[model samples]
Target: MDQQFGEQIGNNLEVYMDYLFIKSVEEDHMLRDTVDTFQQLWKIIMKLNLRKCSFRMEEGKFLWVIVIKDGFKANPEKVQAISLIPPPISLKEVQKLKARLVAINRGRDVAQNPNDTEESIWCFLCEAQLYGAAEARKQFLEVGGDPRPVMRQAYNMFKDGGDPEKLVDAFSKGRESEYFYASLYAGLYYESQNEADKAKVHIVASCNSPYGQRSDDYMASLAKVHCMCRNWEL
Candidate 1:
């Protein structure tokens, strides 16, 4: 709908599914928007149910979210409903839990405020990681984040089904990166795919990362132990 009247709506509109919320600072602008929107809807042969509509209200509920001049806020009653959800027991239920988080995250648009905050975008990136690196990268970009580090790029490439050896080759053109955490991820992926030789090479490189040694991070040590247990040279 905004495609037809984007100039008119601007930031004064928010649409979700079939629901629409239109805001205007002046009474005449509100009336004009209402008339034009309704006329467009009818012209498109869509039906508007008057009984389900409210007008000229200072504040109202939209999809359980309360909207007012001060801006939108969550409906406590709906939040209480969510809190009553039972604990998940199985992997499928765990997946369900993640899906529920995605639903809860719909309360705000991460792309709307790229400069102010990114809690919502990071939350998305966390869940998207399960899907693969492409999904994760898209969420990262929505908040103006760059997915750059050599190892980070390599990990994302491998996770999205690119070959492990190809990653090392690609990043080695100008420079080489121990890629710490990212190399571990790529190594794990290679190991899972039965490419043990490729996994050992990357994991050993990860074992030598200066950042990991300085931080004394447990995962870095764990990677070393894993290589030892497998009898792979480090």
Candidate 2:
């Protein structure tokens, strides 16, 4: 983490702990207990003077550990000190840093399209958008480059006056992973047509199409539809 950002993290944690302590407790005893524990923890963190932190890859995911000055490991006991420490830098931040580093450190390819057949450039562009690469994302979408070809095809089929129900049918036969996004778009299309029932059906189907990146968020939004309407299950 950069020195500037670390300072911001330390400040936020201190404020968060304070906020938690001041919030109502009588109405929610559990809240009070949790706040108390965090207050104690924050005190310990303040004592430890934390410095650099690194994220290590474990089981295809990232885990962060703080490295204090002079080979000391920042632990829970160093609550107050840790509280003063900034939040652990996220992988998303790391990727942004990497992109910036590449832009500055590596030579640019002026060539229209370099020969990198091994890598799916479109997918890389998708990853860029997913990682908050706004400029690249704008360029990618501006060129009508849809990384998700399956969804694009389905949409084209719809634009060509294809049957909406059949569009849903076609996507239902897609890979389970594709079903959620496809259904999400399909749901929107149906909803616009005043087909609330069909829209609900497609939205619920997408939510059930194997939980993925935006799946939980989508499903949570549709929870009322699920509970109230008792719509399609799986």
Candidate 3:
């Protein structure tokens, strides 16, 4: 079904399992693109459950999480459930609490840090590692502070097949001046995936960043990335 839809609509639509998302580069083309998408679906006799559908929404729930125009967020109901759980008194109850904490942290936006001090944040990062909190780890790396332990952890995670897309998404949410390390990591991930075009964009961005310009390691990595991309003008 996805193949058929892609054949018909090309880049104008995307299918994820049973869900379909229609996109257009220009606002004026949105209605036309949607109509074209529907026409292809109609030709295949694809029936959409309208109750499960929304259009032109700025924000909505998908896969049990809330997605806003800016980024993803935890579902309110899930947060409420976690909040309502009583304090743990037994081993089993402590395990349940741990599970709930993992779930809450998984859904949280990485950029929002409740901790203030470096020591506290490092403690949180260590706890995040213990719980496999990939989002937290990625965000901490992006925020850029004292880099020794955090960078080592990030390297370990990358070696263990951590998703690069999370770092890429974090890069998009960060300020330009704050994105040097995020861009570098994202570029490395894309490079590892054999995506030179995507890799070059981030690598070049990192090379131009103030932080990147000051770091010899970043400069070396940037040169290697440029060479890989066959961009000799660097």
Candidate 4:
């Protein structure tokens, strides 16, 4: 709940709400008081500035739908709703719902069907979703699947001796090393141009990573880098 995050949520409530709803309630099958749930959904709808938006329960299922006054063609009505059978009660069922929603929101191709664009997109989206969540939740072990796209994003951000705060923000919580290291290198570029304090910050952050295994090899590599800068010893 950083101030910037609050502002971001305010700015892109639609996207964030979609994500939040998917992550917290819907996916998890966590039931809220019926009125409160609708109220929360209504809040998000308002933020989207939708002309016509509402939800309904039919045949013991919930249907959340949105209709922009004059947006797209066939589906000017972009609808996404959770078809709830009843109030969720079991933790196990909730977990399944969570997993399914995670797969859907992330565009993860859980089915492994290459011909399906939705599946591929879902898979990639799922990866991006997982990437963000893992960072926030400090779950680095889960981030080892594919580093290509993630690295690419980090690299672009690292260009031209990127901002330390921006790099750190993008690095995620427990998985700071990847971009933290990238930022350190980028910061070194600044250091070479006489930005010692900035370089020190990045290096120190990496040296104190909460995620990277503090293995001897990792520590030694960090020690060497620190030594190179004549900043810290051992």
Candidate 5:
């Protein structure tokens, strides 16, 4: 960023790898700086997808943590997912539970707006923890038995040597939403099996597809966030 805008606008930006954060206190300042930043990037032939771009957001997620006007806090959705699981009994389940717990770390201290009232739920999902949580949820559903299995079918397609490319081909033609979503979960299953190449292909396939790029759903950002957190190729 400094290489482009130099000191004039550099201090207001918080960039971590490819995640660029532009901060401004006043509304007018935000508007002016945002335009300036874009114009500068455009000169270099760099462009941002306006659909994926968020502006004037009072609250949102950054680095997997919830960001409010005051400061950052843990994501409640993840906490809810983890909390939903019953205590593990089997040794394997216990290990799985421990892995999930280890992923939640509330160590960062952002002083911009301190909140004494905030509950420290704390975390960002690593690729392992992300898929592990899915695995746990899958087990939770399969415990007694699923007479009609949606989650099982989704999780097993790759696990059982099903062709992901064929699934992508079929889903892509059926519905734009289905294609993106199916590919995302398919990537997770591949990742769990240590199939990085397959995982990357599926993960990339999950995003920027016809429907995903056009949809207003929050999951559209999931693939990018997943890649960023895991250092996977985007």
Candidate 6:
């Protein structure tokens, strides 16, 4: 059926199992492209369950990820689920928590200390102090491995203090393009503080960054940042 429809609609339609994605490069041509694809579907005797279908949407969930005009996003429900989990108490619980974090992060390796014991993991989860700028900077410098995670932690520290400039400067020493999530966090922090112009600059940069263009998680964050900017305008 896909081959038959592909012959008719050309490159405008994509099919996976019973799912179909009708797309067009130009917004002006989208309606016509959808209509043409549907006509082809009808000719091939393909039935669509309209209740399960969406059309002309700016964004929607597909395969558990939010698909948007610019990119894909992590599902908020999944993020919330991870956040709601109780802190690990036992070794088994810590392992479970580690597994859950890995899954939520799309299989990205969860940070683990080489010398960590089960008790240490539990303490790290339950007794970790929220750092201030000085402590965050100290951690960022001392942990000279992946700067991205350190920058994120520092950005969050600044964000909690309503300091967007500090958040920006936290990652400015490195390539800004490499820390798209930090930039987006800074943008949101600025937006929360009613700094629309500053927020706009960071949000736009985040949306267009190489990481944003390539990673689904960043894309999802971009979708949220876009919505926040739109709402601010309204």
lDDT of each: 0.59, 0.41, 0.56, 0.38, 0.57, 0.54
For every candidate in turn, the CA RMSD to the true structure comes to 8.8, 21.3, 15.2, 17.3, 17.8, 18.9
Using TM-score as the measure, the top candidate is 1
For candidate 2, give the lDDT of residue 190: 57
TM-score (C-alpha) between model 3 and the true structure: 0.35
Off by over 4 Å in 4: 1-146, 157-161, 174-176, 179-183, 211-213, 216-224
The full ranking of all candidates by lDDT, starting with the best, is: 1, 5, 3, 6, 2, 4
Please write out the lDDT profile of model 4 over residues 30-132, one tens digit for every residue. Answer: 2333344456557556343345343332211112222232211221222133454344688545545554455433312211221232233223323333343
TM-score of 4: 0.30
After superposition, the stretches of candidate 5 with alpha carbons farther than 4 Å from their true spots are 1-10, 16-18, 88-95, 101-234
TM-score per candidate, in order? Answer: 0.43, 0.30, 0.35, 0.30, 0.38, 0.35
Q: How many residue pairs clash per model?
A: 0, 14, 0, 9, 0, 1
lDDT of 2 by residue, 95-173 (tens): 4554443332121121112222112223233344344333433322111224565556544433333455665666667
Clashes of 1: 0
Off by over 4 Å in 6: 1-11, 87-234
Q: What local lDDT score does residue 122 receive in model 2, on the 0 to 100 scale?
A: 31
Put down candidate 5 lDDT per residue, 104-205, tens digits, no spaces: 433233222112111111121232445643453332211111232333345345333465566566566656777786677677666666678888888887
Cα lDDT tens digits for candidate 3, 41-158? 7888889999988888767765446766565677898889887989989855775577556545542332233112233333333444345444544433222223443343335445
In model 1, where do residues sit more than 4 Å from their true spots?
85-101, 110-234
Stretches of model 2 off by over 4 angstroms after superposition:
1-143, 157-161, 212-234
lDDT against true structure, model 4? 0.38
Task: Estimate, for each residue in 38-104, the C-alpha lDDT of model 1 and write its tens digit.
Answer: 7767777888677887889878887547777777787787678678878889865776667566655
Cα shift from native, residue 24, model 3 (Å): 5.2
lDDT of 4 at 163: 57
Provide the lowest-lDDT 10-residue window in model 3: 107-116
Candidate 3 global lDDT: 0.56
